[model samples]
Target chain A: MNLALRDIRHHLGRFLLTAVGLGLLLGVVLSMIGIYRGLVADALGLVRAPAAEVWVVETGTRGPFAEGSRIPGDTRESIARLAGVTETGSMTFQSLEATHRDRKLRLQVVGYEPGRLGGPPAIAEGRGLARSRFEIVADVKTGLVVGERIPLGGDVFTVVGTTRGAVSSGGDPVVWMALRDSQVLQFRLSPAPARREAARGPVAAGAPDTINAVVARVAPGASVEAVVEAAKRWKHLAAMTQDDQETILTRSVVEKARQQIGLFTTVLLTVSTVIIALIIYTMTMDKIREIATLKLIGAPDGRIVGLIVQQALALGLIGFSVGASLIASAKDFFPRRVVMLPEDAASLGLVVIVVCLVASGLGVRLALRVDPATALGG
Target chain B: MTGDNPRPLVECRGLAKHYGEGETRVDALRTVDLDLWPGEVVGLLGPSGSGKTTLLNLIGCIVEPSAGTLRLDGETVWEGKWLRPDLRRLRLEKVGFIFQFHNLLPFLDVSENVALVLDMAGAATTDAFARAHELLDYLEVGHRKAAKPSSLSGGEAQRVAIARALANRPRIILADEPTAALDGERAGIVMDLLRKVAVEQSATVVVVTHDEKILGRFDRLFHLRDGRIEDMASRPGDLTG
Candidate 1:
């Protein structure tokens, strides 16, 4: 037992090299796990921001992103009159591509009234949107810092504040602006379309005076389900709890992205397992003659197996530690938030250990098959 | 020579081993009988393909014989079936083997390589290290205990192997051309060390060698030819005949 560990310590350089290789592979696995968690966090951030108990959207629609949701802007006024309706605010959602500093950036525009029920909850830098029409608060992911001017439709809005992790279900950075700007950005007609509309004279854009959806807060001890049921009685509207809205966003808007990430994670894990197995197998093969000699000299089978397994586990632990540290330090450099939770790291560590043990099986078989007589022969 | 002791340390009766079957079968050992007692150093002199290694391997319990009865320290080790399922444990507790190449683990230092055998046999760390140091001192290699095998000369490495063999104080020691890789002076030193250890420990030592220069040191000698024992001499200086 002492001899095994002494031998490994004596050959520290080789072991460290093997461990480093394993560590890099483990880093990729950890990063994949973190990215998946980050996706879920990003999707939930928007719903969590409002601090609203229930949501009102068009009937049979998933949410503001997945399906077209349009209800009269005044629907909030009606919902506010209901029992247990503490407060209500109208909000609009749209994804737009705009130019900033010769670069085209895509953003999910969230429009709301300042100091209202639904708005940018917290600012990481500078002030929140103070003016009603031209000021905007942007997520840092949009690469727009404070005072940076970005064109939305035909108007240029100065970035008044920067927030973190404010992304839509599709991972687009969320930019908060005044409700009128969002409505105009989403529904405003181009010059030619405006001319055509003017020529048509009396043609009315359906629900021309309405905003997209109403977000509402319920009073204490009020049943959200009752309010949602009452809102559904309107012919063109539906109401949902905050949890239901999150489910809609996850299942409808980000389903494909989630599947893509899931497939990628599976592939990376398989590759990591195979890589670890090959390395352990190769190391064992290099020591075949030595193993045979050890067995011939009266070393027990358990000791031999222990040596191999110890080496494998050492490799995994060292690699995982290095990989975990690397991912934690480098996560912020990534384009998306890599949420490395302790539970995720703990589970990944266990998986790496299992991978190492399974990988050592090949080497164990090779070792057990060695004939002690070979040590006696030429 | 007959003594009051009922069993020799090692005894083989009509041991036969054949490789392959039918027309292609070749006899590696054929009906050989031998007895080795404690405090005796014997030399096996043979040409190539003369079953010297095969006989050594059988005595070392590395391979099974087709037909034979082997007794070690009054216990029947191999008859119709193996007396012990743990052959490795048997080897560790009762026998020591030295090969032509020093065969020291390159990753281990001199003392560690020697102590490894005792450690494998479940000896305590301090006891194993003390025994290893004692053996190294006996072989006059104690000063180089911390050096790796790769850093040692041919003679020093072989001495380490000898100390390793004696670490467990086995009843029988099998040396297969242990001095084959050394020059005349180093080979003589290794042979003298083997003789001294054998006499001091009262353990049986068997050396299989093609070297004729050091044949005079053994208490007995056997000459093998074509997988059969041809001659057995009781006197060491009788090789002139």
Candidate 2:
């Protein structure tokens, strides 16, 4: 009779209805996992944008995101001079606002040398920083069009090229300009500081040579850790390999929030486990008479157990399929991007298989306890 | 095949079953003796609470007797509330049962319901279905082989049940009120079908019933009263159509 399939066929509406309900709960759990992935992707995008093999910052601090790191702008020259260093650039990051009519745009301004490693990694349209000081290459997220003019800090720059997914770890669209111009913009003193510098007269009319951090790429086959150690020897500086920076960004920067969301996902999955167990147990209970009859007819114990386990797994698989579809379709509706990987789905399937087997335990116990004589009745 | 040493298909001596412990213990069956030979169909008659079903259950190996012995097809299967260790194997290989309800698995078609017995007995799929089809054809329900139990008429469903009981080609068929829910005509059809399967398949058949109308079909009738067989009558297929 293929008992499991038969039972499902006999009660398909009820089975599908329960699966949908379970699927929604599972969908919420899968969504939580997707949000975690998005958080990592967004956080790492900026760190990965430079593709720098090593970073040099102020000594004893984690990195730019976790702490302030200011080194002399001229340090890029020294870093590039190192034996195995292939390329070098000094960069600055700061949040700035520009008013275009009544709509204000918030962006993270990035200053990088032209024709160097620190510029926008890829261009989606137009070109990269065609003119230097007055031209800007912007992320598509900025809602600006090619050749458009936007005024920022008393100077209007032309948008020459566009990039996709070029945002800061904090999700602000990135705006690229020449390193020198960024230095001038970022190092601008507040009125009080400018007044204090003015008191010292023309001696300080020119800004100091300073930058947030220096980024470097190591030669192919050269160890980045060795380069970092060489840079860190400069007593006034600290250096981190790319992997260290990734850790600091995801672990130090986003770990706490990720863990929080991860906790909710775990809770939801636990609830799913219990709910599946209950549904299977209830289904088994409803068919107690049939089970007893089968037992009385001398069906083997393994056969009975197989029926319960198979039904439980069928329920789990259908629920997961529905939940995965729901998460995939609804991802765009979420505020943050939701990344669902195929590997993650495969991994979740393994876990659900185990959960289903464990869930069937309750039903198997109750079924085995049934007296076959019950089929004869009182 | 009829010789002095021809083995009995089923034999029970002083078979007893009791329920409860201490002061509340009661005997559901007590010290009953009986014998069933191959190709014999027996009917057990009794009123409510007379332990007719209890004796049938013991004979079918679904329950253990509290006292005495049971041998099936020349093998001693029970002694004093203890059943043989291989009881499940014996039951699967040698026993068939029909209940008051048709009890065909509702999700399966008539053929699958019949084939399930051989499947459980570890028969190959093609062989199981082939035998199932043969049985349904013999029972005159071949046209309904693909119909699920829920859609089948009463007579058709019971006949399918009869087909299932005969699926494993068991040595004995124990039917408890097989016609309980059927009209007279349908009951007569089921009884006739069961007798035909019993004799043609060469299995001893035991029926426990309160219905007097179908009494004429049995080769021998045992009347159970207060856990004892009160009478044994031999008259074969008097109601056979």
Candidate 3:
């Protein structure tokens, strides 16, 4: 009705205030949904970005998270000689604590051959690691810029490039280093331990050195499942397709984080719904006497309901706009990535509207029960 | 005695209204009857809780009487049951109501508040606003059209309420203590405005009030006491006697 809109415009300040409050709640919900999607994306990005089709690891162990698996680094040479094996590269994975800009940060160090199967896919700033030993490509979340020196394993390594969204399943930022550096970080023992081992026996000289996981690419037209099964016959190792590796990573590494975020999201949604309901109820109560007057004057029940719903919708819309803007500006400032996808925002807007409508039921009931006769008396 | 001359704009016979039941029962109005014709202003004089409001509510179709027949413009609106289920439509199309407090929606400006009834009656938005503006111009409150109710004086607010009542061009307008909140001068001004609107629009107007000073302005007067119309007078001097 024209009258209702006019009333809302006339009281635009209060209406806007209410809407802004609702928008903030909607924005938070949207960001939460986006973060969940980002988590899945981050976990799959490293595996999916590589063109590899099959992974060879120790038998009966989920490498990269569940257990450590080290095999002879030269296994790649043997795997490359096998039928249907197009290309193969050995990679080492280890988690390390490093100091960047005087801040202690945990990083997942990945070692791979330069310009080979395993490496940083894309660089957002600077250039990808060019040298083999001392250069590193770190995720931008580490706050390390190009030319910055990071202290890791009692040595300073220069940051050559920065990548975006390259985080491990545990949310630790990933850093790509030379294979030798990764192996040293993973297998190098302290002097006390190395000397202690040497003292225990006459260590075999020229023995084969072991490294973690061999990532391989299958020849075009080769069935990945068949190649994986063929590689499984080796008693000392297991083979997995890219998809299976992703599932293992999610289940083994990020399951607890997912559960924690999911619980937080549910709690936030509940709080948002309750906030909307309370606001609608309060606004409706403020107009009870006026509603009775309208009813007494023969305004139809539908008209009354329409007015309340319109106000509720307006509040939700306003709140969502404010909340979305706030989240967009503040998301990156959070310690974790707060992904704000467009579809997620759109869905959140719909949720806000639905919550507003559902929230208005309490006020509508109160309004319908208002006795029109109350408007007649003093 | 109904003919082509058109019955009184409002007619109530043996109208009775009771509240509660059994031991706690109270009679707010008992066996009251009154008539209001077009182009006339009638005053209902009574003290507080004397059934003046009850009679107004009954005529306004807001409250149904326990026993009575009410006719408006020669149409029987109530007998044992409400003749029309959509009383809201009946009110919007046939009757107008004014209250002492003005009761203009505070969130809406003066013009929008006046136009609300016409908008509810399905009039186009432009047409509703135009009618509201025209009525405000008639009542001389057009200058304050864009102002909210709180910004206006008591007299201006009451005038806006009157304009709203007349926006739908109803056949009858019911004013319950319309001047109860104003001073003597403002009350007289409001009463005079009501009289002018009723006569000019050719609509019946009923003013329920305890203000004895404005008794002489009405074409007819009725005295309500103890929930019944005990005294009726065609002239102001009948009460003094």
Candidate 4:
């Protein structure tokens, strides 16, 4: 039998307990990695589904997620007139909370034309939006089913269909409605404010035609960069390629969460390395007599080092395996999506193995320093 | 003791060891000289603090002599240049060591403990275990070959240790108080086994001990007092001739 397995079998309880403890800690680290991935995925899911090669927003703004964009609704018409522009759709997004089933349900209300790029790519249940007003397509997470009616902004809208994985950058489920109806809900004032506005004289009610941004899809053999450059010439418009939108979403919208997760992952890795080193050192200290005897009996230094290193590697492998399994199962309980990609687990496993090798250094040093003379004692 | 020239298996000339420096300098060994023949048992007898174990350690090559030349089978194995890796390999291939405690790996069974020597010697697993079984049977612990060190009685454990030491079939065995923890009967039995091993294996055996009960069992005795040999006398007469 190999020395590592033999040693573990000799102290089965202690070895298993240590491995379980380390595995739990590694599970948290793995979850953090998945959570970060989930944040990026959720942030980009809405931005990418439209299949628009470029987005047009107000100048001096990163995107709708980073800063409010108040581009004129007519910007879509101006952008469509450009060469190689296959389709252009004006869309608006706003976070709204509605009481449904006596529960506060938060959602991102998306305003888009019925037949356009910004509509739901696929519906999970029922039919997508078919009417022009008072009809909605909701994400499955919105907890609303087909044919359900919910009071939203001076109107009770019916949920006509349900879409999966369609969430805003902030993880709010999305609801799709006709552009004109969304404009009324977003820009129209309450009845009391409207009466006060009438007394102040005839004035526009927040300009119902204003939109958040316009998305454009390029024709075949057309360059997204060329379209972006053309759209940028409109002094009041800020145009970005899909890559630019993803960067803004990742580096700004979810930037703080990413940094926090990054810091946590680093701290967890450091703690794991230190804990492994300490465990290995303690084990080596306990076996000083056996090691000295082995040395005195003429076992080579390499063999001694191999014994210590093999045990460390075994510990890391077992711990990481437990951690990965935990993440694979526990992800279902997470409210936000937990995306544990196969490559992520594999990469973390490799890192843990490297950490195991480095952590074995302390134990190897102790084993080597064990005077063989100690075995020939007085 | 020196005899007709097959050459001594172990020879030490002016072997000395000192620890610390300057004002704290303490000599652990001082100007010791000795020769051991093949197929002989040498009892190293000394009072507490007489440096019997120190001398044992020097001969075992666990401690380098401060000043001396140590020759094993007429080849220089120790000088000042122990930093060279060849010395360690020489010790591994040419010497076996036993401690007062059995010191067998607690995780390993008796047979595997014995087979470890062959493993270190790069023997194949089948051959190593076969030789280990043969040695265990020869040592009379073959019945307990599958038992862990923790389960064995003191005598059984020590016998297994002897089997382990003999696994590589080295030319010399250095044992330190191999029977210190055993009672008179077991002690005598262990001493007899050492004597038997020397005769049957044609290997030089040096045992360090203060057990007066087994004194008569040695072919020769070397008494130590204050890091120096006081006497080298043959037991009975002209033994191992």
Q: Count backbone overlaps in model 3.
A: 4
**Over 4 Å off, model 3:** A1-4, A124-132, A189-208, B1-6, B182-189, B200-202
Pairs that collide in candidate 3 are: A19-A319, A22-A319, A23-A319, A23-A320
Alpha-carbon TM-score of each model against the true structure: 0.95, 0.89, 0.92, 0.94
lDDT by residue for model 2 over B1-241, one digit each (tens)? 2234377888999898999979999889989988788877889887887889999998999888888999998888887545467666687789988877877777678998899889999999999999999989987899999998989887788789888988999979999888877788878887887777667777788998877678887888887788888777676343222
lDDT of 3: 0.81
Q: Rank the candidates by lDDT, best first.
A: 4, 2, 1, 3
Between candidates 3 and 4, the TM-score winner: 4
Q: For this target, which candidate reaches the highest DockQ against the unseen true structure?
A: 1
Task: Report fnat in order of the candidates.
Answer: 0.71, 0.47, 0.71, 0.61
**lDDT tens readout by residue for model 1, A227-323:** 9898888888888899888887678666777788778877877887787778778877777767878988999988888878888888888999999
Please name the candidate that would achieve the greatest TM-score relative to the true structure.
1
Error of 1 at B48 (Å): 1.0
Candidate that beats the other on lDDT, 2 or 3, i.e. the better one: 2
Report model 2's TM-score to 2 decimal places: 0.89
Q: What docking grade does candidate 2 earn?
A: acceptable
DockQ of 2: 0.49
Model 3, B32-121: lDDT tens digits are 777788888888887778888889888988888888898877888899999988888888888888988888899888998988898888
iRMS values for every prediction: 1.5, 1.9, 1.6, 1.7
Error of 4 at B174 (Å): 1.0
Chain A TM per candidate, in order of listing: 0.92, 0.87, 0.89, 0.92
Worst 10 residues of 1 chain A by lDDT: A201-210
- Please give the lDDT score for candidate 4: 0.86
